[model samples]
Target: MADALLEFRGVNTYYGDLHVLKNVDYSIGRGEIVCLLGGNASGKSTTMKTIMGVVRPQSGQVLYDGQEIADLATSERVKRGIAPVLEARRLFPRMTVYENLEIGAYTRKKGPEFDQDLERVYQLFPRVKERRTQISGTLSGGEQQMVAIGRALMSRPKLICMDEPSMGLSPLFVEQVFDIIQEINKQGVTIFMVEQNASMALSIAHRAYVLQTGVVVLSGPAAEMKENEMIKQAYLGEMQVEAA
Candidate 1:
């Protein structure tokens, strides 16, 4: 894509003797909601880790806004506008909801912009505002997920990478979270998410990539992917069984 905001070219990552990502290539365009879908141990979380600099590729290019960033520190990447709402809603359990959101702005200098961004997060997640003084760990799973997303938005990111945003929530909360993701995308922040809920992800995504055993097996427009027989048999079929 000519306006690609993030691109991974020929990325190969390993953990000791176990190879996790193999020659993976993906391009997420500006203002797009791009999802990475896969089953367990398919290296989906590794992909998110590589993007966040938690894990480095042995060889290949990780470009953000056209600049190579495979070697940049996680803080540097965050400062450059790449924020991650990590898997399972990783939050400081002891901190209040508002305090956790404040930490997301660690890389930025405090000012009026901080207040504006905090308000923006509140506008997006009113429940979070309601629970601002509550300890994050005491909140329900769905409430914690909202705080996690709000924390990411506090950074004013141009791109937000979400890992399994629907991992552990009720069907209703999953729908609410997906709706918020769409709203976030509409407001112009590009999203690169790793999700097991293929149907929900594709329902909102502009494009998607399917990974299996560390390799990208399919990729294209979300509408086309939803209709792909291979996708139906492998991913959607499982979702159908669960729904039934």
Candidate 2:
């Protein structure tokens, strides 16, 4: 963890009288794919929000590149090389695909670098390029997901925090999206994802943490977690039942 890109040290977060995150500690090393796994009502989404500065921790530290960012604004966090692919693919419904992508770079000035980044996004999602002029709301679910990811990449992030990348999509699209996530990670951007699709997330993640209520119950290498009996019963087995 010497080269940790993001770290949470004994972090605790609350919403009014309710405690959402309880002394959580997480360290995401540079160039790694880390996933957070949990069921409904767990603190999974809260963790992502805490990192993005959407929610402030009541105590403990949130550090990025060794700098404290708990008090930073969301825009400042994005400016510091952290971008989020928020839950549910929140795209501007009235805007064209290209315009939605343009919004992603709001923190950066439009320049030659922006153009190059746009081309990179296009290369990653050719379908997005084809639909650049089309309204984002009109695109299919799979295509929308692609554009959501493309928009995140347009920020040129060092760490991409994704909340449920496989939330709603056909099986084919889910597979494609996960494949694209791996491809992006291979290009050296660290990924911290919160996913309900346990099997798919674990398959691609280097490490994973399991949250229950407001506490981390289990965490370790993804391979070992996949083989864990508790994990199988709690997550993978449930997935199989749904598939059945």
Candidate 3:
């Protein structure tokens, strides 16, 4: 049966009394690729952190699979099928690529299933197979990003939230990153990402939300949002073409 896989209702958050996210209400349907769009400090990252339980919301409800999960711990949230790829590319610098991914699945039920998880991660990043023993710190920026993403997928979560996955990459690599996001979504992994690459986000996302200083100023189908006047004026720098 269809259901709202994740929901944030009237959520409010504060960083030491400085309000960050204000009454944010959003939801992601099962298997949907939704992009959260905003400039820096627009509460995009805060939203992801709040959902992942890294930052507790000062108010409002966070629901996952119809259960209120606002009170859960970070590890508990991961066990409940919510995994996040942070913008910081937080991989263990001294660890081998395989070791890093293995760590991501540390909370899983003990069994042969853990090995199976490694196989799944290798499938997504075949280069990971070639560099399984290499230290993540020595890898290039793009490779580090891959490790971060691969690690998140190691949990085999139903939803993956990536914060600015394309930041700090060469122009050539940016296209490759977007393709990877698309490929993952095609494999039926729901994605909720915060991306500053406006054009790429709108083109790839199935739907998107535009946040302005902790408020959702625009949201709709990806195609429609791509053409939105505010989005074009601010991000695209051109009006969207009408259907001919």
Candidate 4:
């Protein structure tokens, strides 16, 4: 908390009449991988949206780099170097991979910086480079995911909040995606991710938080979480009951 890169305090958010996030408290240190683990509708997506300023919080504060960012809108937040790769992989259907990534650099279009950013994203996702002229709608699900992540990276964000990066990939693709996420983090971006696959999330995360019914139920280092009896039984695939 004393040296957190991002912090959310008493954050409460709502959609119409339904309150989605209730007094949420979270923090991520610089260049750390922190995963938000929860079941369906446990407010994981809301956390990302709230941080991105897509959904405004009525009674809370979000601070990034020690400055309050709750007042900033979505575009403004992105301009401040926060990028999000959402669950649905929102890519321009008719646009080429290059075009999609170009949109991500809307805020950073200053001479050679824009060119360098494109090169960086292409380096991170060579699949996108190979498909530069190809329309995004025709790509496979895994390729689409790569485009989404690459588009986000084109912004050169200080923090990248990924929501369900492995939602609908094959086992191999899922592993590949997780590996890419780790690689992205290694390049000095603070990561706050939400994933349904607790096994994989815990395995890759440095620290993790388990949320249920919009509340944090557990918090610990990933190694301890991986060995946790409850986690091992429920989300990490069923394990034999240890000698009742």
TM of each candidate vs. truth: 0.98, 0.97, 0.93, 0.93
Count: clashes, candidate 3? 0
CA RMSD per model (angstroms)? 0.8, 1.0, 3.6, 3.2
Tens digit per residue, CA lDDT, model 4, 1-244: 3279999898888899888888888889898899998878989998998888888998888999999998888999899889999978999989998899899888875578888878887787788899999999999999999999988988889999999998888889889889989998898888899987787787789999888878888888889998887777666763233111
Off by over 4 Å in 2: none
**Order of candidates by lDDT, top first?**
1, 2, 4, 3
Q: Residue 76 in model 4: shift from native, Å?
A: 0.7
lDDT of 1 by residue, 136-244 (tens): 9999999999999999998889999999999889999999999999999999999999988899999999999999999999999999999999999888999989878
Q: What is the lDDT of residue 31 in candidate 3?
A: 80
Off by over 4 Å in 4: 238-244
TM-score head-to-head 1 vs 4, winner: 1
Off by over 4 Å in 1: none
Provide the global lDDT of candidate 2 against the true structure. Answer: 0.93
Q: List pairs with backbone clashes in candidate 2.
A: none
Candidate 3 to truth, TM: 0.93
Better of 3 and 4 by TM-score: 4
TM-score of 1: 0.98
Per-residue lDDT tens digits for candidate 3, residues 1-244, read 1368999999999999789999999989888889998877999999999989999998999999999998899999998788888977889999999899888887786468877777876776777778999999999888888888888878878899999998888767778778888888888888999987788888898888889999988888999987678888776663133111
Q: After best superposition, candidate 1 residue 161: deviation in angstroms?
A: 0.8
